[model samples]
Target: MAIKEGLRPGGRSARVQDAIHSAVRALLQEQERSTVTVPQIAARAGVTPSTIYRRWGDLAALLADVALARMRPDSEPAETGSLRSDIRAWAEQYLDEMSSEPGRNMMRDVQASATPGYCVAIIGAQLQTILDRHPHEAAPSVDRLINLVVAPVVFRILFSAAALEVDELHRLIDIALRLD
Candidate 1:
C-alpha cells in the first residue's frame, strides 16, 4: 500500500498504529483469538473503538496489518553469488519461516485481510532486491519469481498439510530462472 508521505514510523499516526498492533498481539497471547473484541483492543491501545474503525475497518484488517508487519524481512537475502543459488537459499529460508505454526497462522490472517496484495508486494520487493544483485545475469523478473515461486510456496504453507521442502523450492527457483 502507498503510505502517506508523512505517516512513517515515529509520527503520531505510526505511533498509534504500532500501539494498536501491539495491543492485538498482546491480546492474542493472553486469550483466545475469537474472544478478543474491538473494545478490548482499543482499551489496551488507549484508543477508542472509532479510531480503530476509521483506521483498520475491522478486526480482521487489524490482524492482517499485524501479520504483514510480522512478515516483513528483517534483513537482506543471502548473497550466494549466482541467481539460482541466491533464489534457492532465499526460498528455502522463506519456506522454513512460513511453514512454522505461527507463520502459518500469520499467512492465514494475511489471506483473510483486505490488503492481501501487500503480502505479494513484500515478497516481490525481496525478489527484486535479489534480482538487482545479479544485473548481468539473465535472471527472472521479480514478477516471475512471485508468480512461479513465492505464490506456490505461500499456498502450500497455508493450505497443504505437508511442509514445503527445500528441494521443491530449488525446483521452483530453477523454473523461475529458466523462464524468459
Candidate 2:
C-alpha cells in the first residue's frame, strides 16, 4: 500500500486528484456504483486507501466529486446575445449531461451525500457566468433560475418514464424566460 508522492493534508496534488478521478470513472464504467469500493479505487488509482480517505473522506464523496467534475461544462456557456437563447443553450447542455447514465448515477450520489450543495453551486456558477455576460435585462437570482430551468429537468429525469424531449426543454426555457 504505497501512497502516491506529494501527499499533504489540506493541499492535494493535482496529479493525485487526476489519478483518483480517472480511476473512479474507469471503474464506474465497468462496475455498479454500489459495488465500487475505496480499496478498489485506490488499487486502480495506484494509491493507498488512506490516501483516498485523507483526500475525499469516503466513497460517496469521491463519486460525487467525480460526477460533479464530469458534469461541469467542458466549454463556456454559448453566448447567443439574448438571455433566453443563452439560458436555452446552457439548459440544453445541462439536461443532456444529466440524462446520461453516469450523470444520473452521479446526481444520485450527490443528492444522497452530505455535499449536495457542491452540485448546485457548480450549476449556479455556470449560470452566473452566462448572466454576467449580458446584464441588459435584470437576470434572475441563481436560485430562481435553478427553480425555473434546472428543477423541472431534474424532476423529469427522476420521475418521468420518457426522456426529456428537446421541444419540452425548449418550452421550459421559454417558460423560464417568460417568452410564452
Candidate 3:
C-alpha cells in the first residue's frame, strides 16, 4: 500500500490497518487462499470493500502487504563474540526460515508487491546490526552479506526444491567474510 503523506499512524487509519491485517491473518488460517475475497476481508475487517480497494487496489496487493509485514525481522541477530560466529548464526537461522514451506510461500507472496527489495533492506539492516557489534574486526558490507548468503539461500529454497545445508551456509559465509 502506498503510504499517505502526513497521515498520522495512530488514529482511525492505524486501527483500520491493524484490523484489516488481523482479519486477513485469521482468514488465511481458516480457509484456502484462493477462496479469500475482497468482500470477505472487508466484512472481517469491519470496513467497506471500497476501503480495501482504495488502499490496496486489490486483494493481491493487500496480501502482499501482509506478507511483507510478516517477513520483517522480529528480533535482533544473535550476539556471539566473533563477527564470523554472529554471521554464521544469523545465516543459519535465515536458511532455516526461508527454506521452510511457509517461508517459501511468504517469499512468493511478498514478491507480488511492487517493492520486493523492501524485504532485502530489512535483512541488510539486520546484518549490519550484527556487523556493528564487532567493530574491532573487519566485516563484509550488509549488501555483500545479502548477495553472498541471502541471495543464494533464497535461490536454493525457491528454485532448487531443496534447502541449503548448514555446511553449505557456512561456506557461503566464509566466502562473504573473505572479502574483508
Candidate 4:
C-alpha cells in the first residue's frame, strides 16, 4: 500500500519514499526537530527540496509522515479474549511509542501543526476496531474509552517532564476499564 496519500504507487516511488523516511529519521536522531529543514532532509535523502515540498507540502507535514510511519503498529493488536488485556496491550504499545525521543518530537510537530487531532483519531479508530471484536459488557463508546485511555497518557506526557512508568500506565488502563 502507498505510505501516504498522493504518492505514485510503484517501484521507484516506493524507493524514494523509503529513502526520504530513512533520511528524516536519521536527521531526527542527530538534530533537534526545529533545526531540521527541508533542504537538509532533501540533501540527505538525495532528492531535491522541491521533491520534498511537492510530496509533503511542508516540513511539519514531512515530520508527521515520518513520525506516523515509525509509530504505526507492525500488526493488529492481538486479541487476548478480554477487553482489559486488549486495552492494556494497546495502551502499553501507545505509551512505548510516545516515550521515545523521535516519537515525542513527532508529537510536538503534529501538535504544533494544523492537524493536532490526527493521532487521536487514528488511535481511536484502532481502539474501536478492537472493541468491535469483543463486545464490552457496558458497551462504552469509543470516545469515552479514548478519553479514558488516551487523554491521561497524552496529558501527562505533554504536560509533565517525567517519563510514564509501566506501573502508571497499567494503573491508567485499570482506571479506564474500571468505569466499564
RMSD of 2: 4.2
Clash count list over all predictions: 0, 0, 0, 0
> Alpha carbon lDDT of residue 174, candidate 2?
68
Tens digits of per-residue lDDT, candidate 1, 1-180, equal: 222456666888888888888999999899988899999999999999999988878888888878888989899999998888888888888888889877887888888876746877888888888889999999777888888888888888877888777777888888888855
lDDT of 2 by residue, 1-180 (tens): 123456673465777888999998898889887899999999998999998998777787787778767777787889988887898888888788788877678778777667647768788899899888987886677787888779888888877876588898887666666633
Backbone-clash count (model 3): 0
Q: Which candidate is the best by TM-score?
A: 3
Query: On lDDT, who's better, 2 or 3?
Result: 3
In candidate 3, what are the lDDT values of residues 26-105, reduced to their tens digit? 99889988899989999999999999999888888898888888877788999988999999998888888878866887
lDDT of each: 0.84, 0.80, 0.86, 0.77
Model 3 misplaced stretches (Cα beyond 4 Å) = none
Estimated TM-score for each candidate: 0.87, 0.83, 0.94, 0.82
Which portions of model 1 miss their true places by more than 4 Å?
1-9
Model 4 pairs in collision: none
List pairs with backbone clashes in candidate 3: none
Worst 10 residues of 1 by lDDT: 1-10
Model 3 TM-score on a 0 to 1 scale: 0.94
